[model samples]
Target: LPRRGADTPSLAAKRGKIARFYLAHASRANNWDLVDLSAPYIIGRWLLYPDADGKLPDRGILDTLASHSDLWHQRIGIVATLALIRQGQTADTLRIATRLLDHRHDLIHKATGWMLREVGKKDPGCLLEYLESHFRDMPRTALRYAIERLPEPQRLYWLKRQ
Candidate 1:
């Protein structure tokens, strides 16, 4: 059974172990059905321990879970990363968000925008700077999200560019 507390070291270790176990299983598990079981475990563990110190995951570690190319896993990863940013881990999130924007996947594009929107909520000027630089290149959905919280007039102005 999954543990209920986030603060316990033992529980944290257990979650990490579960996540690693599922990740290993995902590598060998051919059925997409089995892959689903690992998805939540991996995402849950990442949510539990976002790398707030800005250390990228080791290459070996990333290789182990490379199967996360699955759309569902990418979506969950994006949501978890955004949740971290919303919780005020802006510096760390900025690193993650920047990398996500380079992803070719459309879902990741939207997720990057979602995180940028939260950053905008904390500092609208910063968002505007990013928008001014990237709006023309960003996916429409992403651009809209990054601008969604702006004042009515500002929102209309950006929307007009669409």
Candidate 2:
């Protein structure tokens, strides 16, 4: 189980250690929920947290995990972005969605599509732009999921593109 707060003075350092420990034991995070809950709190937060200098951390970790062979880890890469998404950050979700577009697993397709739909919820224009480029090639499951919340006419447009 992850502790909420460790030591305030060394919060960042301790969180980094905790994130590393959880990631090192990622194999134990076998299911989608586990990965979803843990990634944002640990891995995602660790990588995205700003330091005292106000410099944000790099997001390469998500890209690496997104391309990992293990299904659970791959799911974690996308699902973790939910944290950023809720905070109105959509760029990471879009980038990760692009990388996972060709993945064959239904679970990966679902996760990617879910995130894309969420991005749409926050920024409809962004989702429209993404679908314009990739809707034709998107897996049926993903495409359907991505357009699930669109108005009927708009949803029909993307469905027709398939």
lDDT of 1: 0.57
Displacement of residue 64 (Cα, Å) in model 1 is: 9.4
Candidate 2, residue 51: how far the Cα is off, in Å: 4.5
Per-model root-mean-square deviation over C-alphas:
6.0, 3.1
| Candidate 1 residue pairs in backbone clash | none
Local lDDT at 67 for model 1: 28
lDDT by residue (1-162, candidate 2, tens digit) is: 224753243566666668778878888889877886787777766666653344565787789889888998898889889778877888898999999988999988998899899999999999999999998778999999999999999989889879
Candidate 2 residues lying further than 4 Å off, grouped into runs, are 1-9, 51-55
Model-by-model lDDT, in order?
0.57, 0.82
Report the number of the highest-TM-score candidate: 2
Q: What's the number of clashes in each of the models? A: 0, 0
> What lDDT does candidate 2 reach at residue 134?
90
